[model samples]
Target: MKHLDINQIKEIIPHRHPFLLVDFIEDYEPGEYAVGYKCVTYREDFFRGHFPQEPVMPGVLTVEALAQVGAVAILSMEENQGKTAYFGAINNCKFKGKIVPGDKVRLETRIIKRKGPMGVGRAEASVDGKIVVSAELTFMVGQAGKND
Candidate 1:
């Protein structure tokens, strides 16, 4: 198992602030599973509009965060690096709780299956051990080497 700091994660995924939701990857097992964190802050751009007085991380962003972590997990596999994984579909997605400012949300992803360029996985978001969201995500991995 390995941990990925923000800088290392930046290398694997093309996401940045306001969009780069994962702050730190806590644990990762190549070709298996990965866990990451997102610390919510009042300064987040969406909070300004989502609700000025009472800010809460939107459900969509929560899902995106999970997806980003999943992407890192899949790409970290030796066979997938330097490849772009495009989200193909999200299935059985459910938002169970609210994520507010000051919350540290943990995202966990597990590879369910991988066949050729397509892969399927399950992801969940939690805060203080409480699940907030979960989904089954499918994506296509396009290797840069292929067209280069």
Candidate 2:
């Protein structure tokens, strides 16, 4: 079991501020798989308008958290360092339960296959051992030159 703090995760992926969702990664294997967590809280900006009384973490954001975890795994690789993984497609995504503040959403992603810059990952989000969302995500890794 490996671990990555916020700073270490930032070294791999370029997301920042409110949009960056993953809090910590506990299990990571470069280019293979990773498991991370997001600590949902009432202070989140989206909770303000998503619903005033009953706030729920949006399902799409949950998927994005999973994608960020996937990026951590893929970008941590030596060859893929300083790169960005963009979403190519999302398939078979299903949300089974509601996720609200005070819940910790555990995100896990594993690369199933890859060809050059394109790859597929099996991703899921769970809370208290209950599956909340599952999806097969397609991604394309990109690297920018100093000028670009």
Candidate 3:
């Protein structure tokens, strides 16, 4: 088992700022599974417009969080470092409960299968031990090209 702080996570996944949904990875097993967290806060940029009076973390962001966790799980594999994970598809995504500011979301992801450069994963987001969102995420790992 290994743990990934934010800085280490930055080396595996290329997400930043408002787009970087996972705060830190709590635990990980290369090519197997990973757990990460996101702490929702009132100060978030989206909260201001999402709803001023009733701030809630958007469902889409929850999915993004799940993807981030899945990415960490896959990239941690010894064969994948320095590569990039690209969103391939999402399936069976369901939002079960409202996630508001101040909620600490725990994201857990496990790899379901892998073939060549593509992998499939399942992930869930929970709060207080209750599931808030769940989905199957598919992604492709490949060499990262230089940004234009």
Candidate 4:
């Protein structure tokens, strides 16, 4: 298991500011699972237009955050290093609650199946111990420029 800060996460994934959703990785196993966090604030760009009176994080972004956590688990593997994990599909996704500003979201993704460079992860995101989102994410790992 390993704990990763923003810089460390950058080394593993190609995401950058304004897009990198996971702020910190609490702990992660190379190819098994990862637990990460995202601190939502009123300062987020989306809050401005999402609603002036009520700022709710978008459900798609929430799902993306969960996918990033899963990417950490997939890309961290020794054999998969330097590879990018692309979303193959999102299955059974559900938004059970709203995520507002000031909410600290806990994201987790566990690799439940794997075959070569493709796999499925069981993902969930919660705030204050209450689940807000859950889904099964399918991913395909491949070199950045080469299609395979």
* TM of each candidate vs. truth: 0.93, 0.96, 0.94, 0.98
Q: Assess the local accuracy of residue 119 in candidate 1 as a C-alpha lDDT between 0 and 100.
A: 84
Q: For candidate 2, give the lDDT of residue 82.
A: 85
Off by over 4 Å in 3: 146-148
Candidate 1 lDDT by residue in tens digits, 4-37: 9999998898788868999999998876778999
lDDT of each: 0.88, 0.93, 0.89, 0.96
Any runs in candidate 4 off by more than 4 Å, and if so which?
A: none
lDDT of 1 at 71: 88
**Superposition error at 31 for model 3 (Å):** 0.7
lDDT of 4 by residue, 1-148 (tens): 5899999999999888899999999999989999999999999999999888999999999999999999999999999999899999999999999999999999999999999999999999999999999999999999988897
Model 4 TM-score? 0.98
Ranking by lDDT: 4, 2, 3, 1
lDDT of 3 by residue, 1-148 (tens): 5788889999888889869999999998888889999988889999888888899898998998898898888887888887888888999999999899889999999999999889899999999999999999999898888331
1 or 4: which has the higher lDDT?
A: 4
As for TM-score, the candidate ahead, 1 or 4, is: 4
| Distance from true location, Cα of 40 in model 3, Å | 0.9
Model 1: worst 10 consecutive residues (lDDT sum): 139-148
Best by lDDT: 4
Which residue pairs clash within candidate 4? none
Model 2 per-residue lDDT tens digits across residues 32-108: 99999999999999999888899999999999999999999999989989888999999999999999989999999
